[model samples]
Target: MLDLVVLVSGGGTNLQAIIDAIDNGTITNARIRAVISNNQNAYALERARRHGIEAVCVSPKEYADRELFNQAFLDTVDAYQPGLIVLAGFLVVIPPAMIQKYEKKIINIHPSLIPSFCGTGYYGLKVHEAALTRGVKITGATVHYVDEGTDTGPILLQKAVEVREGDTPQELQRRVMEEAEWVILPEAIQLIANGRKEA
Candidate 1:
C-alpha cells in the first residue's frame, strides 16, 4: 500500500475526504502516514490525531530562512517515508530542493482551474473571488503534480463547476470544494497509484 503525507493549513475537509476514501476502499492501495501543518491551530492536525495518524507542525517562524524551513519540512516528511505527498490546503511555498527530491510524487489540489486563477497569492477564497470577478461561466478545481512554480505542474485531473450569475465567492467555493472532495482528489490519487503499478 502507498503511504501518504498530507499537508494542510486550515479546516481539513480535503483531508477528511482522503480518509473517507481510504476507509471506503476508493483508494485501495494507500494509507495516510502523517499530516503536517504550518499552523498549530489547524483543524487538520486534530483530524489526523483522531484517526491515530501522526500529526505535526513545523512553523516557518521557527526557521530563520526559507531554505531552513524547507529542510525541516523535508526532514519531518522523510521520517514517514511517504510514497506520496498530498497538499490539501498547505499555504507554504516549497523550496526547490524538496521539489526536486519528491519530483512528481508530490501532488496538490488547487481551488481553481490551472493556468487561470492560480499562482502566488491565489489560494483559498481568493481563487474563487477572482473567478467570480472575471464573470466566468465555469470554474472548478484541479489536481496536478507539484513543481517549483506556483500551481504550474502537470495536470492529472480536473472537474468543472458552473458559475451562476448571482453566486458569491463563498457559494462558489462551497460547490468547488464539494467537487474537489468527491471527484478530483480521488481520481488524482488513483491516477498516481495506477501509474506506480504500471511502472
Candidate 2:
C-alpha cells in the first residue's frame, strides 16, 4: 500500500477525486495518511477532515521567511512518513530540502500536457490560457514525478483533451480537469502502489 500525503491549496478538486477513488476501490492498496495546506482557508483541509484523514495547515505567513516555512511544511509531511507526496494544486515553489528528501517519491498533477505550457511562470489558468493563445487543438493534463525543475520530471501518465472550436481558457481548463487530471492522478498513484511504475 502507498501511504500518501497530499498537499493542496484552493478548492482541492483533485484531492477530493483521490479521496473518492480510494473509497471506490479505483485506487487499491493506497491510503491518504494526511493532507497539508499552506492556506488555512483551503477547502482541501476540510476534505481531508471529512474523510477522517489528518489535516494540517502550515501557513507560510506564520513563519519568518520562505525557508522557515518550507522547513515547517517539510517537517509536517515527514511526520506522516508517506510513500508518496501528491501535489494537488499546491501553489508553493518546492523547497530544495523536501526535494532532496523525497526525490522521485513526490508526484504532481499539472493542468497542461507539459513541455508545452509548463515550466516557471506557468500555473493555474495561465497554463490553459497559454494553450489557447498558442492555438493548440489538443491540450491535456500530466501526472509526473516532481523534480527540482518545474514540470520537467519524467512523465507518468497523460490524457489529452480536445480543444474545441472557440474554446475559452476557462472552458479548456475545466475540460482538462474533468477529462484528464482527476482521472490520471489516482491511476498513477494506483500504478505506483501496484509496483507498476518505474523508478
Top model number, lDDT: 2
Cα lDDT of model 2 by residue, 32-84, tens digit: 99999989999989989998999999998999998888889888999999999
Residue range with the least summed lDDT across 10 consecutive positions in model 1? 190-199
- lDDT per residue as tens, model 1, 123-163: 98999999988999988999888888898989888888899
- Against the true structure, what is every candidate's RMSD? 1.6, 0.9
Distance from true location, Cα of 10 in model 2, Å: 0.9
Candidate 1 lands at a TM-score of: 0.95
Clash pairs for candidate 1: none
| Candidate 2 off by > 4 Å | none
